[model samples]
Target chain A: MSHSLQHNRRLFLGALGAGLFTTRGAFAEQLLASPALTEGPFYPDQLPLDRDNDLIIINDSLTPAVGEITHLTGKILDASGKPLKDALVEIWQCDANAVYLHTADSGPKKDQQDKNFQGYGAFTTGSTGEYRFRTIKPVPYPGRPSPHIHVKVSQKGRELVTTQLFIRDHAGNLQDGVFLGLRDILDRELVVSDFEPMKNSKMGELACEWDVVIGRTPDEREFERS
Target chain B: MRRVLALSAAVAVCLPLLNSALRAQPPGAPPQGGRGAAAPNAESFLQRLMQYDANGDGSLTLDEVKDRRLHALLNRADANEDGVVTKAELTALHQKESAAIGRQPAGFPPPGAQQPPGAGRGGPPGAQPGPGAGPGPQRRGGRAGQILPEFVQDELELSPEQREQVAELQKEVDAQLEKILTPEQRALLNQPRPGGPGGRQRPPGAGPGRPNGEIREN
Candidate 1:
């Protein structure tokens, strides 16, 4: 009887340990691979009032952001280099005033926040698995770990991956553990951004091209999950 | 025994015809603005169309055709936006999408932007081409780049402003990238190097994927 009881206890402990580890692993598996970043506290709690193609502007309000506007474009290819058609990419960021769309964003007051920044935008990949977004260049925000762009990729109502794109030249990268962990070239392959001269204006245009590689193998599942 | 043999012969004779008659192919190419991949036998476009088929009907409706989810994709293959997608169109769209899906996040364009005069292409999804002349497969040699040379300079051509616009966008990202990433990461970038457990080398001949399709590095 003692032996049988011991066996049952061992089984119970194993099951309990498995559950605990699973929970921890799910929430904290480390974000690497895909250059896309997290939405952070900037994702709008509610949709913007004036939802245009331009994320740089919140509504049709007269003034746009004082900072440079960027045209972020790129294609999503699989490891095999094939394009994943019909994919959806969502991105969010802080406005020029260092304010995000989230409730926690710091500013003197909520309404006082710069309403010109669109804060978030979505683009659907066409047959070429290519997508584009219009927004302002991400500026430094107070107390944030680094200047980063949070992104999410999805297809057929299923979330494929959500990660952050660290600014390659940011001084904070060395300090950020996540960025350091992705030191390898493949880990940082998509971490790219380029600046272009403005058209008929003083401020130049900012360009960003990120090639995201979604995990197709079974091993890729762990990284893709939130 | 004789009757059973006769029935077996009848079943055998009908099977091949049924298989050929109801193939699960993509609707052929759309009428306008179609990329070369969607021109004929690609598989990706059919997958998107299948998603819109809510009631399992063999055809598409205005609602299915106009689904905003499919706007960018369907537009690539639809050409004229007449709302009906065919198998030939589906093939090209699929091939195009598959390549795009694999492309690096740099701006890539659609294929078939240009064609050698009368060089032959795929059909609209389900619509058969001229007698004995179906849309040929993999005519681009392989997925060269996202933007076809023809389209990049033609009807779907990128205006000088657009090109400048894209270049400026790249510049902005480059600034941010320089400011954000470590010198080590940046060094490895734009050049191939040793990798980690994740595997570094992007295998060659990715079997018709993106990173090509006219995403020129200039």
Candidate 2:
């Protein structure tokens, strides 16, 4: 498909998705809470110059990072399905070569690291609880089989949940111990995102939508305990 | 035609680079056995299989497939669908992986030579810091050295001295964050931490912590 056509389709879908969240607020209580997963080690020892949501390009670089460009977007919600505004959402993952932004790892493997790739990025959710990141599809690392992106959510400057998101039906996921350890099928499903090809793009860009549902708000948890 | 030639040329270059690196391993030096030590490009995958084939029969059977993941892929590795996997089949599998992953694997540095220090899950155990280790505490129990600080630093693009100053302001940051919490929330935050749940994770080759204990980036 033509690149412009696909781009338009994506924008329309993005708007539609946001609209659904707005209309579904009354039914939000029925949504499943996103399962929590370990934050994992390579969260980036050093941050890149561009902390924006677009990770494909670093601060005005013409050469884009190598990898299948993935449009990652999601919403942050509470157990009641209320969108959490002003929440900080951060994500970090390895570049196409499976190297992270951390100095210890990237320092030695600097030759292999993609200098153009912004290894880490963050975005704040607005009233819609929506966040988006243009990054590469996560690849399997040496020890870990499942390709994943580490995600952290914070509100009011306090961490809510630290988790990781996985690719749905990645062949390696079956053998991944961390993925298999999740005994609850629902929780397992929550962490995986569908990486579908954009409608008409020659570049094979992928679009992923993953909503994060925290088990409880900090205030709610504290109030319940009292 | 040009792409094929280029690809073949790249493969030709990689074979020798990997072989010489394999040969350089001192006779019987303990293999860098940890999962993080070996980079899994096409060449290394084949090299690793040979290392497992202790008898040098040039063929590997199920018994030789010690790594569970390789064992799982073993069935598919048999291109002819034969029970036994021959070097020919392994080569085909390698070719397939190279094509699918879109990586040439020719440019990677030699295995043992380019490995980052403190390679395994965090630097040698214990909180004691290693040379060049960052001022942060060593990674332990899956909670040490974090990405959040780095995220904050990068988002603000703070200078090195400013970063140090920010680190010094940890007490203030904590106080500000604490103000947002209710009394009950404060108590919960102060409670003794529980041992982290198991399910090891890392960024490609990055283990839990570095020797310098800088920030842990898992």
Output the number of the lDDT-best candidate: 2
Say what the interface RMSD of candidate 2 is. 25.1
True contacts kept of each: 0.00, 0.00
The DockQ scores of all candidates, in the order shown, are: 0.01, 0.01
Q: Give lDDT tens digits, candidate 2, residues B7-122.
A: 99765544433332233221111121211222233433454355455456767777765433245456668877777887667656554433332221111222321123322112
Mind giving the per-residue lDDT tens digits that candidate 1 earns over B45-140? 243245345445544444554223234344456655677665455445554443332232221112322111211111112111122121122122
All candidates: TM-score: 0.40, 0.45
Candidate 2: tens digits of C-alpha lDDT, residues A20-138:
33221222223444545555556777777789999989888899887779999988876456789999999998777757898866776677677777989999999999999999888
TM-score of 2: 0.45
| Predicted model with the maximum TM-score | 2
lDDT, candidate 1, equals 0.44
